[model samples]
Target: MTTSSRLADTPLAGELIRGALEIESTGRGLLPHRLPAWARAQCADGQLHMAESQPSGVRLVFRTRATVVELDTIPTKRVYAGAPPRPDGVYELLVDGRPAGRGSVPGGDTLHLDAATGTAARRPGPAGTLRFGGLPDRMKDVEVWLPHDETTELVALRADAHVEPAPEPDRPVWLHHGSSISHGSNATVPTGIWPARAARLGGVELVNLGFGGGALLDPFTARTIRDTAADLISVKIGVNLVNADLMRSRAFGPAVHGFLDTIRDGHPTTPLLVVSPLYCPIHEDTPGPAAFDLEALAAGEVRFTATGKPDERASGKLTLNVIREELARLVARRAADDPNLHHLDGRRLYGEDDFAELPLPDGLHLDAAAHRRVGERFAALALTGAGPLAARGRRRV
Candidate 1:
């Protein structure tokens, strides 16, 4: 299964991949972005640009007979001030569409984030190499799943034998958009994220648009989803809006309607599920903009606390309780008219009782175990029954 070409000669670039909308070659690697160049041009803020470029659900697929496969890349790792270092991003190898092996490449530039100042600084680091060896001699389909949370740049890829793009899988494509919780905020690895887990369980290809701290129910995001090909779609709403204190109740209903309206423009019959926020103790009854607990940070702990007063709800400020109520009401009304539309209480996936058993560690995001639990619960709730995503059919909508 050996090839005659040298490592330098066989370096596969982004053109061999199918998922990325934009791929830009850098001095060290090739950066792949989820949003297209046209959509990216519409964005002016650096934060939004960075969030959309984090290659969530983007995978490099190929077929190879090589025993050894290698990848060279630079991953943009996050470094939060005063908090413990998070795990390195994972690159999962799927042989014939099933997980075969996983590896993490070390050495990458770090994005230093300061909670107090709400600013980020980049520090340069060396590129890391990922190698997967000891594969079967026969040719097989392979897919390299990029980090769900990190911004990855593909510098090069090499195989002992020839490698070509893997054949497409005839499976439903599930497009999902959400906030940081869906973005693998505290999850240990990329594949460990709930949506990734749910995608596998549901046996569907994934197109994740979960942006960390960036899901503000943006019109651009809705338009992007509308343009993307999806048989199933779900939008996890409310957490970012509530935690960021971005909108009041009055704006929430109309905004949700507009977002769904935009997505329906393209996917009129695609089953769409609307999910509310999970159980976050800090934002359940209290309103946000959630602030970091500086005292806990000084003690080398990352904790979130609501800054807005509980009485703010009467003034239209959002809380988890308020958001859940509004979202349920909105979805119910929409479902009454549109059969493809459905609603799921995020609490049903991770409710109060579950919280008492496996509570959210940082008062915001769920831990790895919680992620697994939520993912399994969601698979059962959304992928079964006479629900919207159960079977494809034209209904009276």
Candidate 2:
């Protein structure tokens, strides 16, 4: 018999296996309802290392034949010094209110959890799906327990579900790169990351290359993008570079061009949008190292300040205005010969008008509502052309 036929005859033989569960926080609490726990564990020593400002919560979940389930509880808001010292203790995973499994978070490992094993490590892999094998056909609830001293934020619960995969299309893929904001920071769910959301909204397949604190115009990253598959693509730049203060204008322009040149080597005519930074008050017109408020840190508040003098424009510091102007000029020069190249102000996606109504609590990342708004705008701008390969053509207004 054919492999497909043979597998069909055996119910579990070829059945789809479950992967890591992904869950995102709705507010300051867990997502509504109990979810199935396929697997769970604790990252004892590394449970405290997180973004400069984040709440403490556990990242736990289950993997099933078709879907991944996650359970997360909000913790008290506080600023952690660093990863806590190693603790030898049992982290519990409960499925349907009963103990399913337990594991220990090893010392010297990163605080981030591995979706597959549910242990925290000193360094985590790039964000992606985690897979698991064997699960009960149906389940409704799950819970995870960490030591009282440990804390975490339930950012995402990701898992593969049994739903039929969307039919594969002949469309060209879109490869994109950005920063933590693009990496889905502060998002409520894995699929809710702005790029993922926008990809879905635009009806295109996407390979998200966003990495937290990793989009510093690194040559390796540029090469990776240049080498990746894509019919058309864009890069959301500026914000992270500015926040990190990685490079000044002298190098920024060439880096941008070089990044494009590398990509063009493979995709000569692909429509590429070079996006500038979005609205950020502190970096609006200044350079870095962006100063952080120690008082805020002591108070468990996270904030950034411009480190440059208000009147000086020659300082090494960079502002959103500077990035935007450079990007527009760069694209204008490139578009003259490269018709497929384009530019978009990130503000067009999330502008001052939106901020006036709903300001970011941290002055950096967008909230769930703001993420949705940006996604919708991105969809309208990039998708909807003759076919997936054809450039939909954005007008320079």
Candidate 3:
């Protein structure tokens, strides 16, 4: 047998990864996980399992002078059973914090899911390479951002020169958790995702906990956040709860309190901001358990619509409006004693005006342009002068 012509023997270490909490060695390569193994072990839900492995905000960061780079990866691309095929996941390259190039590995694996039946099938494929050439020859920091929505298994990293972990930045760390919107639904590129964009504009290091369809207020998730080290923390709540129809008003308040309590156990005084959900007309007053728009799916487009009735509110069924009011009250009451705590109405980031101009194409997640607008708004509102997330003693100069 002839020897294969690939150089991937060196094992990947945690130091090269930025946003992931854990790295697992697989037969193929190293897989980054946003949640710890303990937390992942506690979950049996396939959605959560898949979301945590997607590496939404994770990137391989290093210092190198290589003019050419190659990454061997196995990306598990997703597809709705009847909907049009999704595009391959994109890997973005950044040189010294500036956009340099973008590429995608041709093939790896396919995950076919039936939304109506809530079933999924996985098919394995071969690993592919992502190559970037003609990079600057001078030594500089290099970052390879993994696809935000795809499950990517990194087999090996190859460069023309020596590679080492990039020095940790002195910026404050911003840890954020939310739903698919924050996880980067519909945002074409990884860096275009609102959180990534916001992290850049805000001049902060990001550890994103956003998980698609898996952001329910779970104790294990809260515990994960509690154990993590963050200088500034924010949890965007509401949309996922409403869409899943996971809890009624009665349970939501206590659950929110419990979630915050768990985090406070670890960080008693770190600046904590609780943000509500952005505006979605379908769920504004209507409760959910949102359903796919079958007609749209049949027409080769994926869309979502609320199924719960508006009248359910009388029975403590939660809606976006109900969630906002409750969150506002909870923050106000708690902020009195906890001076560092604050609340942001999510609509402030993307509201009616934004909706009119840039509608959510899938009726739930923001498109690429909307994500950029939201990130800019967030940077201006929370990361600038005297804002809720303003770095202590550092103001916009």
Candidate 4:
């Protein structure tokens, strides 16, 4: 529906955004960025850039009485060469903190990605509108959650009534960083991602720094975590390091220590949890540098496989098992004096038994059901009794 005379453009400012560290006022409208400008400027990798641009847990929150709402956005969607077309990213509507509606824009810019070669050809498209009507005709808190897997540029927000920034949530912020699984992967929607789900279940505000193929233990990322204020902090390590074959055993331990040290600089005594990688059959005992399962891709399916030889572990190559062992040992060694530091075995979230029932379709990322399982497990393990944040007192889920 076209905006009536009473409808006015609601300035999409940083105050309207949650789960993002910065907002960039763009030529089109506004863009929410998970990583700050300085951290982004330090990395030139296309993967990191794209991952951060996809607002995994980001949402636009406001209080309004409008019965009709419209949002215009230009989403940069990725399409793999020769593979089946991916679905349009979804925008989830929450009214008074509950699911109310869901919609997707029809057209937007496209990134034609080559899965095998890791290259993308960009094609610009016109902006599309997502309109929600029949909203409750009274002042209510509304949230429009951006697509978890698409890079979106907010163009406009219009309503028949004035919109104001919603009151900030009175919950402790939970900052989490990890790989594609934490970035949503195949979780289906923005709030369905594991971290988002866990945040809801645990009653905490979420600041997710999970990046697809961009979780390398970079100094800049550590600094970002150090500066961001959070009541609970977690770093899910191992998966990306192994898949990218980024570092060997000798370097991994020191890198992890340094990452934790940087965060402690800002959050001295906050409850910090170091979670190891979730179980992945492909990377359990096999060292990586994982590669695409070309045969599956040829059949129009996406799958990943480990390429490093098992024997390489003897020479310092990292595998899921080795990384888990190292992380557990390091956390145990450090907890001697750092009482607030804790470790959770990643298998506790997704173990071999869970895998049997819900095998990872792509041999890497979790599907929607698996995402729910992991999220629920995380809430039980880290947000409740005997967990790292136990002292904060659990909220009703």
Off by over 4 Å in 3: 1-11, 393-397
Give the range of the ten consecutive residues with the poorest summed lDDT in model 2.
1-10
Q: Report the Cα lDDT for candidate 2.
A: 0.54
Per-residue CA lDDT of candidate 4, range 204-286, in tens?
98899999998888999989999998888899999999999999999999999999999888888888999999999999999
Instruction: Write out the backbone clash pairs for model 4.
Output: none
Better candidate by lDDT, 2 or 4: 4
lDDT of 4: 0.91
Each candidate's lDDT (Cα)? Answer: 0.82, 0.54, 0.90, 0.91
Model 2 per-residue lDDT tens digits across residues 260-286: 898788778777777778787777877
Candidate 4 segments whose C-alpha is farther than 4 A from its true place: 1-6, 391-397
How does model 4 score by TM-score? Answer: 0.97
Off by over 4 Å in 2: 1-79, 82-171, 385-397
Indicate the residue-level lDDT of 24 in model 2.
33
Best of the two (2, 3) by lDDT: 3
Model 4 residue 199 lDDT score:
91
Prediction 2 TM-score vs. true? 0.62
TM-score of 1: 0.92
